[model samples]
Target: MRELLYEILTSAGRRMNFEQTARLGNALGGLLWQALPGRRKLAVEAMVRHLGISKPEAGRLAKESFRHNARSFVEIMVTQRMDPRFLAEGVTFADPERVRFLAETKRPVIFATGHLGAWELQTGSLGAFEGKRKIVVVRRPKDQALHEVMMRLRTRPMVDVVPHRQAVMPVLRILRKGGMAAFLVDHNCTRDEAVFLPFLGQTAAVNLGPALLAVRARALVVPGFLVRAEDGRYVQHFDEPLDTASLEGERDEKVQATAEFYTRAVETYVRRYPEQWFWMHKRWKTRPPEEDGQPRA
Candidate 1:
């Protein structure tokens, strides 16, 4: 079952849904079943044996898995479009003229976002606010096919992408030339390098790249997001740059505080539309330190 699950996911030309993803989860159950050699899928077995759920009731829930996957996929698609009006239907920016402040600035700026709804759409939406400076999309490419598909969807007059790894040199060159380099550092894979901060009412690991860049390049570090609204229109949010000057030399304190600040800010946006947030990820997988310097489990 684990082998089958791996094959299915690795299979090109296959799009798995929530149901399929859960079936993969169930395949995890199948591993357990194989060890036991006497059980059905875990969810079914749990509902029937442990919870005493009727066969029909358990069957109904087993079928709803794709709902979770589809919702997740669609939300990501929102950020891939250039126009919010087209993807979000009713969403619009409160103030776009504000971007001139970012565009006209001679220094490079770092835009920080997370794995929130259709965030790639941000580079496209930046077109409305763009002057002459081009927006470079920095991402770790997934696959050749998906990369091309993403390129087609995200490329526009004002926007282009450079793979995140290759981006450092190109981005630095652009920064030297006063162009913007944008990225999301919500999930860094190092300890002490990134601080564990609260998001969605739990501890989340956040990277210090934004602060590091803003400090090194003297670029404005603007925390931004596409906050989902009650009207179902996704509003573009541009938080004024953090006061990094006040945080000078005391970078450790600033990095810790700034990460905490954005974590809360992102949490606020997530609370606005709880369903739009990616709840499936183990965002709280990182445990809070027992003490400030104590290693997290």
Candidate 2:
């Protein structure tokens, strides 16, 4: 029954032409985003502080961001019904050699990126590039039916999605086989599970799971970004891999340093593609303790 419902929803999404669907999704989703008082306030405040812009500019950016984000989400749902080759044809990689070499290497690698651009396409692009080689992606679980729908939307023949809590073994197995794993590391984390790092000029809580896994698995940590080009195409950009040698002493320090390093990498891309990063989520929900002894809420 759930699968049938999902199929019906997806079929409805696919009924519209690509451009028409994108336009409708963007216009309707942007309006809905603006209607949500809580999310609208959060996005406006974040855009203002993060961009150091006027309230009006922040409002404009928030509106555009919502439109682009909605268009992307709708595109993902609609495009899932299309063949992977057709989808792959539209995406271009900034450094094909880097992506090829990394994906083909015998050494385990950790591919890291934030929720920028059409991130769902990143999975497909990697899958297309890697061919039969598996790409394991760590994801937080959603509600059961929605989770099933998302996994269907995101997974490709060469890409596998693993829930975060149970990802350890599968990730390790893949790493041991010299495979790659990917993660989106920009979400808020509980204080106990995250390390505080500078993100867009403010100290924000960042998950250390990717870094910790890299340290433990001795994998190369590569940061990547997917951004929409001015020409209406998507570009997948890969940066130099992170060196964890400086983080070799204590477990906590290694984790913290890795978190900071990757967070900075994410900040770089976010700065370049400011509107692509998801601003509706409370990225700085976790706060540092007060010097006067009162705990932060």
Candidate 3:
């Protein structure tokens, strides 16, 4: 049933113009926002706690976030078959010079981002802009059927997906070969193998895999995101790479510092575009082990 629905949506999305597709996404996102009462509650609470905003403001932001998220999904679907010229309309590069620096070097880079804006299209855009198929993205799907569908719709000529469970080794090899790997660093995990970091004024669990992989592979960590602008266009941002070389300490400390750097980068972007992030995610699901039997501040 999921596959059937996905096929139908993809076929319909292919024929839609930009405005029509965006409208469909807005409708769907608004509907979902209203239907998922539990998720809506969580999103609202997160906004209030993180932004320190009133409930009304949080509610408004949640609604806007839903609309943007749905539009991002449609943008992905439409871009699959749309001409690259049309898709690139109004798109800007935030810091192409930094990207050029990475591209000119033969060293591997770990591109880290959060689930903000049109993240699904980052790899493809990078490949197209740089004229290199050097990116392998890590994806964590909810189910096998959805995963297969995403692989079909999301993978571009130069971009590819690596499932989360089997991603470590493949990512290592890519890095060793002077290739890039993309990671959405804002996921919640069940494993205790994570670093505690301050996110949005709260302590959140962040995976150490990206840091560990970078350390082992001797790769530079470049953090950035593709965010929506005020005029409804997209922009590809590339920040300066994290200086892992200067981070001298125990292996555990280095790993924790690396994770914190990524988290801080994400927080910077989220603060700018508060209403364009994945507010519905349980980003703080896991608590610190030290907080056991104690109330959170």
Residues 1-297 of candidate 1: C-alpha lDDT, one tens digit per residue: 654543444442135432344345445433443453222244343344323468776544433322322333433333443453463444566556656577666767767776565465567556654554555645555666556555554556655577665665666666666677667666534555567775544466676655665565656667777654445445777777765555755767766666666666666655453333433334444555665677543
TM-score, cand. 1: 0.62
Q: Output the number of the lDDT-best candidate.
A: 3
Instruction: Report the C-alpha lDDT of model 3 over 125-216, residue by residue, as the tens digit.
Output: 66533544455556566887777877777776656577767888778877787788888898876556688889999888898888888777
TM-score list, all predictions: 0.62, 0.88, 0.92
Higher lDDT: candidate 1 or 3? 3
RMSD of 1: 9.0
What tens-digit string does per-residue lDDT give for candidate 2 at 1-297? 877887887777767755676678678767878588788788889988887888998888777778777777777665454355654666677888987787666777788888888776667556544543455565656668877777777776756788888888788888777777888899888877777777887878889888888888877788877787767677888888875644568877777777777898888888778777788889987876542365532
Candidate 3, superposed: residue stretches over 4 Å from native: 79-88, 128-131, 295-297
Instruction: Give lDDT: candidate 1, residue 283.
Output: 45
The runs of at least 3 residues in candidate 2 whose Cα sits more than 4 Å from the true structure, single-residue gaps closed, are 1-5, 14-21, 78-84, 135-138, 245-247, 290-297
Ranked by TM-score from best down, the candidates are 3, 2, 1
Model 2: colliding residue pairs: none
The stretch of ten residues in a row with the least summed lDDT in candidate 2 is 288-297
